[model samples]
Target: MKEGTVLIIGRPNVGKSTFLNNLIGQKVAITSPKPQTTRFPIRAVYKDQRGNIIFVDTPGVFGKAEDLLSRQINKKTLESIQEDIDLVLYMVDHTRRRDFEEAKVLGIVRKIEKPKILVINKIDKTTPSYLAQYKFLEKEFDRVHMISALKGKHIKPLIDDIFKFLPEKKGESEVDFHEKPTPILNIDSKTYVAELIREKLFLLTRDEVPYTVNVEVEEITPRSENLTYVKAKIITTADRYKKMLIGKGGKMIKEIGRLARKELELMSNKKFYLDLEVITDPHWQERIE
Candidate 1:
């Protein structure tokens, strides 16, 4: 079967998952307004009567001097498009300035030797004054098309544009709606870890705690029939933050576990034993090498 992969690379909180959900007409990835909500490269395989396009939604890249995990995320995001990226979709905020930080990410995208599409999201927030300066915005992104992703604007044309760039489908693979073949309707490993942590942080932590937290799966094993155990570490840079995660009488950790376990059981379709631990390991911290 003929296949092609589309890499969605952009900064944090730019609506990558939302954009993808709109494209596939399904909720495969968890969408939250929080930055770094998407931590993994989620693959949504869409097979239509025309062809199949594998969309890889990646973690948002933010250039930070403090969090090591964020640095790793940005590194991994760049690595996604560095290899076999058939198309690179770079999402930019139509309402924001091209600061040095955002420019850094764009620099990485500029290096990708593939067809690049600039998806300018959040145009619904724009005014007539903003529209008057649209041309000025266009100059910042060379050969980029502007569209409001949240309002479902220009998405069809955008998909059409993506299909145009994709290599033709050989028509060998038939659509298996019963089995739901071609389009992958599940979140990947990176996404699962990210969502578990994000949902917890969003609920438990306030202020900077939610922003600084990162979750990684240390181990996953199947113990017996219809049973699986997930060992994951919730990482933070500070010991005080660690205390916060544990909370008063370990209430915080328990809540996080309960929520994650419930979601896992629903996804796994089996009994799940989720063991969650908090770590202050600087390995995935905010600092750069």
Candidate 2:
């Protein structure tokens, strides 16, 4: 049996996360139709007669990281490319015009020593000629696959061809498709906290504010019924920003807490309390070493 890991990577809004869901046939990651919806890497095990592919959904490669969380995400995404990845699924949204980052993506691809397959996604919005015209990209990569992950068109051939190119690790030969165990990769605890707080900010803020707000989980306490107390710092660059987050009469913060806590309960399957506070720092996130 062929067995290894595949990393899905590309620019933001390229439908990388959506393609991951289609490949794994599960919704292991959330989709918001927004950029940067995926904060942490999510793993979904794909097992079939041909092989088992552990697909890792990574945050889309974008702007240079200015803060701790953004820096960490970019660092991790690049680091995954350096890992023992079986293949790299570089996806581009075919419906939209390519951006400057497409040049950046080419640079990154040049640096990746591993074998890669370019996938042109969002074909549901294009004509055959639109996809057929990417001869330049076809000449650039060893191989390319085209499909709409949303509609599941031409996915089986892509998956079949993907396994055909994998370099199998030792002990994989002993594995059986029916008997091979599926890997249930869970989110890292520390990263989970950061994502929770970031998601809370994404839910609460508007305009450019959500992008500016960076959260850090400072503490956690365990309690009965599997409850865990969480305290996070909502860091902003100015006192005015902090005041905006806290909202009028503190109502905004309260609402954020209420909404986040309810989602937390649904996620943890336990009751827990939340204490949300705001802080202003010239550059708390600049503390990144």
Candidate 3:
């Protein structure tokens, strides 16, 4: 058996989280179409007969950030590319035009001495010529795999190839694929619960609202063997945004809570009593600093 750590790096909204969820065949990470949807580094374990792949899904690598939150996110993303990693899965949205940020990321990746593979994601939304745009990437990496993380295109082959980068074991024989292997992750319920709420907020709210707000889990109390109570706060920068989130007659917040609770219940496999509140704090992100 072989084991390795693979860091998934890319600019925001490139389906990095989506790829992680698809690879593990579970929703270990929350995802949204909005840029900067991922704010922290999430780790998940994918195991098979070949070995195990511990994946680190990072925030999108972007150029300078004005806010303290964005700065911290960018720093975390770059810090993930460490010597301890066995392979780097550098993903890019094939449909978008390459920009200065992409060039900056490419330059940093070029200096890394670890083995890496260029994964061109979102191929389902592009034409064959999309490959031409990223042709330069082929020369920089040992191999390239074009895939659609959302549509689950060519995911199995991508996973198979990822195992090739892991350290090999002697006297290891291939195991039966029919015997399902259980995937594992070291994520806590509180963090993932907050992420689930944040994902719904992003999908429900409009421009600037999603980025300005942050979800914080206050408590997760087990009411019974089969039931749990979760209390969380949605922190925002201003009162107006809070009003918008709450909506007239508290309809908007109710919808957000309803959707988030449903997902959390399914994820926890327990009845969840989700208590959500929106608070206005202009320096919510900075206060953590």
- Tell me, by TM-score, which candidate is best: 3
Off by over 4 Å in 2: 21-50, 63-75, 126-136, 149-156, 172-186, 226-228
Backbone steric clashes in candidate 3, count: 0
Ranking by lDDT: 3, 2, 1
Kindly list the per-residue Cα lDDT of model 1 for residues 1-289, writing each as its tens digit.
Answer: 3457788888887788888877777556767667776655777877666677888889888867355566677767767776676787888775766666677778887778887777777777764223333345455443466676667787777777787777755555433456764356455564565466567667667777875677777667789989887888788778898999889998898888887777777766888787888878554554433
Error of 2 at 76 (Å): 3.9
Q: List the residue pairs that clash in candidate 1.
A: 45-183, 66-286, 67-285, 67-286, 68-285, 68-286, 69-284
Report the C-alpha lDDT of model 2 over 170-261, residue by residue, as the tens digit: 66343354563343455555456666666666767777666556677777788665778888778888887888899999987888788777
Per-prediction TM-score to the true structure, in the order listed: 0.73, 0.75, 0.91
Off by over 4 Å in 1: 25-31, 65-67, 127-153, 170-195, 216-231, 265-275, 284-289
Lowest-lDDT window of 10 residues in candidate 1?
Answer: 128-137
